[model samples]
Structures are given as structure tokens and as C-alpha cells.
Target: MEAAVKRRVEDYSLMDHATQSDPFEFYAALHEQCPVYRMPETGFYMVTRYDDLRQVLKDTDTFSNDVSAKDGKGLQGDLGVLYEEIIAERGWAHVQTLQRTDPPEHSRYRKLLDRVFTARRVREMLPYVDQVANDLIESWIDDGRCEFNSQFAMPMPGIIIAEQLGLGRKDVARFKRWADALIALSIRKWSEPEIRQIAETELEMQHYLFDVFEDRRKNPTGDLISALVHAHGDDEEPLSMHELQNLMHQLISGGFETTQSAIAHGLWLLLRHPETMQRLRGDMSLIKPFCEEAMRIESPVQGLARKTTRDVELNGTLIPAGSLVLTRYGAANRDPEKFECPHLFDIDRKNAGAQIAFGAGAHFCVGASLARQEMVSSFTALLTRLDDIRLEHDLPQPVHNPSLYFMPMKELPITFKKR
Candidate 1:
């Protein structure tokens, strides 16, 4: 094996774009030296070890997901306050629903979400997912070359989630804009003006969704939005318009972006390991394992913030009460203690499905099933339809956009022969 890059715990910074772009080395360093390292810039603690993260994730009481209570000192910092203010001015105030809430309250929302995003629903949508993947591949297969992210990755999940939300396939571009605006606030650094501009775009989305919510309430259309609007059938209290808005915020952003990252990274992994690609091309049975390993090696949702409810020590390091702790899923997924040759992309690895890329415990991603199906559907179509898949060498080295939370590829230029 090549000598590991010499790095100190101090050398890493989540605020740095370059660090965010390629953090695996830093994650490896964290695994070896500082399993729970405090960020000097933001004063937040990063828990990198797999067991440590599982502890944090499972013990929601100790590490609260109700980050709104922290007064906007979580991942986005004071920018979260600015965002809330902007939305409150023009639209419903942000509420803690699925991703933001804790315990009993969260269970209420989760139950409703589970009803709509059920296994039956995802299985039923498989044909549509397959069709979307095929349609996207067909669009560029004849051209022999395409920018994978813009042309295929972004749209496959986007159109599915859009039509499911009753936004219709035609409004996928608008849905993308809305999702991007919401995601930008969390993942990127921005100036005051830029923050305001992004917040305004979020408000635009809120207003549009609000109109949809009102329509769904009056006349149910059987779409996901309609189901969410009328999910409670008189026995339980229905989700308020405010709660619905926040839930929609989570769904839209969660639905498309992470899956896009996963699909793009899956292809990138195949391109990097031609032998693995060849093995996969020979046996489509390996596609699911390929997806699992892709998610493990290149986690899309790298980390999410949790506020400590009380002072606690993790791996000999003490974290104070009210301190923001980032559960580094990307780091934990590569922990050498958990997986041998942790950095190696091994599709046959038995524990690949155990990766917490979709998170673990109660706050585990609600759309995980859909995301998995989307990835499997995507790669199954891509490998079946295209031959000689290779990257366009002239493009930039780091294809991923800089993001603190997500590992989204900005573009993926590649050439392939239609098989």
C-alpha cells in the first residue's frame, strides 16, 4: 500500500472548500489520531469513528436533533437565523419536522412519511424509475458523449420526486431550483447578499408549495403532497401547513441531491476501477452490491449536526452541553476498525450495506428505500445501455461541487458506445 499522506488533526478544517471537496484523507487522519476533534473555526465537535457516530445517532436524547433550539449555532451558523427570518417574512416559519425534530414528536411525522414513502410505494414506482433511467440514457446514448450529472444524474430522481409531489414532470427545473436554494444555505459559504438571495429563492419555493398545499387540502389528487396534506384520517391531528412546508423542504432536498451524488459517484467509482466495472458489466446481479459499496465509499450526506444536551466524553474527549456535534457519516463509513482496507472500494464486501450513509437509528433517512432503488435502477440501465464508459480526460480533476454536507458532483463528462 502507498504511504498514507502525513496529516495532523489541526490540518483539517470543515470550513475550507478544498477540505470539503476531498475529506477522506482527513477522515483517515481523524480515525487514527483524533476520533472526536473540535473544529477551531466553528467550535463544533466532529465524531469520526463508526461506533462513536452510532452512539451519537442512537442516543438522540444526549445529542439533540432539535438544532433550532441552539439558536442557529448549528451547521449553518448565524446564517440559519438569517434564512429563518427571510422565510418568516414572506412565508411560513421553519418548523422542526422529520429531520429536525426529536423523539415522540418526530415519530408522529415519521409515521405519516412512512405511510407515503412505503416499500409498496417504492416497489410500485420501480417501473417508472427504470423508465426514467432508460429515457435519460436514450437521450444521450446516440451522441456517444455526455455530461452525466446535468444530463442524467440530476433529472432521474428530480422528475420522479417532482411528479410524486404533484409538481408534474414539466416543473422539474423549478423543483431543482427550489431544492438547490434550500441546499445552498446548508452546504456552502455565502456573503450576506448571497444568503439573502438564496433565502428569497427558498421563500419562492415555500409560496409555490403553499399554493399546492391549499389546493391539495381542498381537492385530494392522490399524489404524495395530497397524501401528506390529508395523511391523518380524523383519528390524529393533521400536519399543519407550517409542518407540511418544512417536511416538503426535507423531502425535496433529500429526494434528489443525495441520489444524484450517489449515482454520479457510482459511475465515477466504476471509471476509476475498470476491473470492478467489467465484473459488474458481466454480472448485473452485482449492481445492488455496487450501489451499496458506492454509498459506503463516497457518502453523499457526509455529516449532519446534533447539539449535545449535556456534557459528555467521547473517546477520551469531553464535549460540553449545548455544543454542536457533527456526526461525520463519511468519516465513520471509512473507519479502518469497522472495515478492513476501509478506503478500498470493494463491491463484494459483506458489510457494505451496513454503512450509515443514509444514517442510522430513528433519524435515518426516510427516502433511503427510494434512493437505493433509484441508484440500482440508474446503474442497471447505464451499464446495460452503454459500452466502453470512460471519463473525458480534459475536464477538471475534482468534478464534485464544494459542499459541507453533500458530496454532489458538479459535472461528469464521459464518452460511451451505445450497447
Candidate 2:
């Protein structure tokens, strides 16, 4: 690096805090000074600029996801990295089941669930999706005031996921809790005892899904889980018990929060920005762009973690091997150089397709189409049925994770004007 370039690098350790709510300021600073930043505390490389994030995420070879951080560094002491060797081996089963795999294995596992989420299948699922949304609207319409998060946002999408996987709605509360913990655990540190409790609960979740997969093998059903057991009509290797359970875990986990947050957040966006909300309520066609803008403004998943394999130059910064490389999907979506008035929530803006919310490349979110459909169905149903939907109170400040993986709301109360 040139002397001037070396001088531009700054320490971002001071920005790390337990009580921190908004870390975007750090991201903005990093974007301006250095697209590739090294946090002083954790030593992990942070990529904020749109091009840089795309570069790293698209090249998975140099940037691996096995997550053995380089030189024994990167997010050290995080409870997520505290597992023993034995636990680490067990966790490999968990990891191999989803995000950690590469190429052929990744392709094989991803294909099993792909058919259900493709555009054709998503359209087939739409009537059922609309029914689910309308059912929630019916339940909440009489109340006039509702805790929208629990009453509507949480239930409808989760039930769709449960049925898709051959699970029942009875597991909603437990499944929701487990999903939240798994996402939050990236940033939230827990006591030893609490970690043990969560581990045991995860085991229970695994076992429950395993039982469903096993039973389906004996009595074949058409559900995704059963099909996976029978290789889903694919000539690829039939999923082992571990692979079957893990694949189910990923599908269920992906559906649990991304759809919930998207529904809750699309509503939050419509409620917070009066002009956008008014425009959307008036024009039915803008629903597509509105969903696009909401995702850009408030992405369901914040960032992705990758473990680097070899030294590679990214926008003049050398990312050493085995380091955790974070592609800031949330931050990149707001890169002003790429999107005009990036911070403003305007659905009419051009280049709406430029947002990185669903991610880029082969690792892109598997359920992007399903998520978009759910948002469209839910928003259309809400606007058609509920006379008016607006915020009943101020949105509690949005939550941020040091892990930068989720944008979850604490609470959102809503009032609906009777049609």
C-alpha cells in the first residue's frame, strides 16, 4: 500500500459496544476511508463498498466459510467460537448441513429445496399464501388494535414453512424461539449454563425434525422433507440422516425469520414513511418496487460471514488467509455512489434491482422468490382487507447485531381503520 493509503486506515474498535444500537455510522466511515477495513479489536476484515462486497462474496474459493479464522484471530472469545473439539465435530454436522458447504455438495443440497421456491412453484403456492395472509387479517380485523408482530407477522409465514416441511403449527413457539436464538447467538454472549440450555434445545429441535424425516422414509409423503429422504426425484446422492436433518433445519431456519422480518418490516416501512405509505396505498402496481425499496432500506439479513483461504487483494487491501470476511449487504445496499439518494425510502428510484439484500452469486438466498411472494401476498391482502394500516405508536429503535446478520424488530403495535 502507498504511504497515503496506509495513513488512511483507522481503528474501529471504539465503535464496538455491548449497548450499541446503530453501527451504520462505522460502516459509512469505513466506506468513505477504506472499503476494506480491519477492526482493531477482532482483526476481521470489513468490506462495505458495493463493489468490494460483491468481489469477495462472488469468489468463494479465496474466501471460504469453514470459519477457522486466520492466525488464530477474528472474533475471538465469541461464544460461537467457544465450542470444544468434540462439540466442533458435532457442529460440523450442523455446518455441513447448510452454509458451510461448497460446490457439488452445496449444489446437491440446494437443489432438493430449489423446486419448492422456484418462480413456477412459488406461483403454485400463492393461492395458499394468500389464504394464510387473509386468515391472519381475518383474525386481527375485529381487534382494531393488534400486536402485529405476534398476531400476524409471526404466525402466517411460519405456518407456511411448517407445512412445507411436514411439521405442524404446534411447534411454532419453540421453532420461533430457536430460530431467533440461532440468529442472535452470532452477537449475543450467553452464560455457560444458558449456552448448555440452548444446546440441549437445539438437540431437541434436531431430534424432532429427524423423527419427521425418518417416519416419512417409511411412509412416503410428497412434502419436501420426505422427498429429500428419497432423493427428491434427483439422481444425486440420497441425503444421509444427518444431511436430511440439517437440510430441513436450513429450510425451516431460512423461512422462520427472513419472511417474518420482511412482512413486519414492509409494514414498518409503509407505516413510518407517510408519503411512501400513501403512494403505495393508492397505487397497487408499485407493490413490487415498494418491496424492493423496503428490502434496500431494511434488509431481512444484514451481512454474511466468510472464512478466507488465501491472501487476496480487494480494492488495495490484503485479506490474509483464514480471516472472517464480512460482506455488508445492508451497507452496500445504501452505497450512495451506486444508488442516488440511497438513504431515502423512495420506491420510484431507478436501478431498484441493484440492491444486495438477497445477496449475490451462487450463495444467494435460496428462498428469495418465496420471500418476495409472501411480502406481495401479505401486503396486497392487508391493503385490500384492512381499511387502513398505520403505526399505533413509535417504532422501538431498530436493533443491530455485532454479527451483522439480522434486522429484527422488538415490537410493532398497529391500528387498522375499519373498511
Worst 10 residues of 2 by lDDT: 1-10
How well is each residue in 1-419 modelled by candidate 1, as lDDT tens digits? 32275878788777887788888889988888889999898798999999999999999999989877227675566777887787887899988989888998899999999999999999999999999999888888899999998889999999999989987778888888889988886686678788889888888888888899999999999999999998996789889989999999999998789998898888988998999989988999999998999999899989988989999999999999989899999999998889888888899899998899989999988899999999999998998989999998655646567888888777889999989
Residue 134 local lDDT, model 1 = 97
Q: What is the TM-score of each candidate against the true structure?
A: 0.97, 0.89
* Candidate 2 pairs with clashing backbones: 70-322
> Per-residue lDDT tens digits of candidate 2, residues 66-103?
55422334343544454322233444245474576766
lDDT of each: 0.88, 0.71
Name the top lDDT candidate. 1
Best model per TM-score: 1
Global local distance difference test of model 1: 0.88
Clashing pairs in 1: none
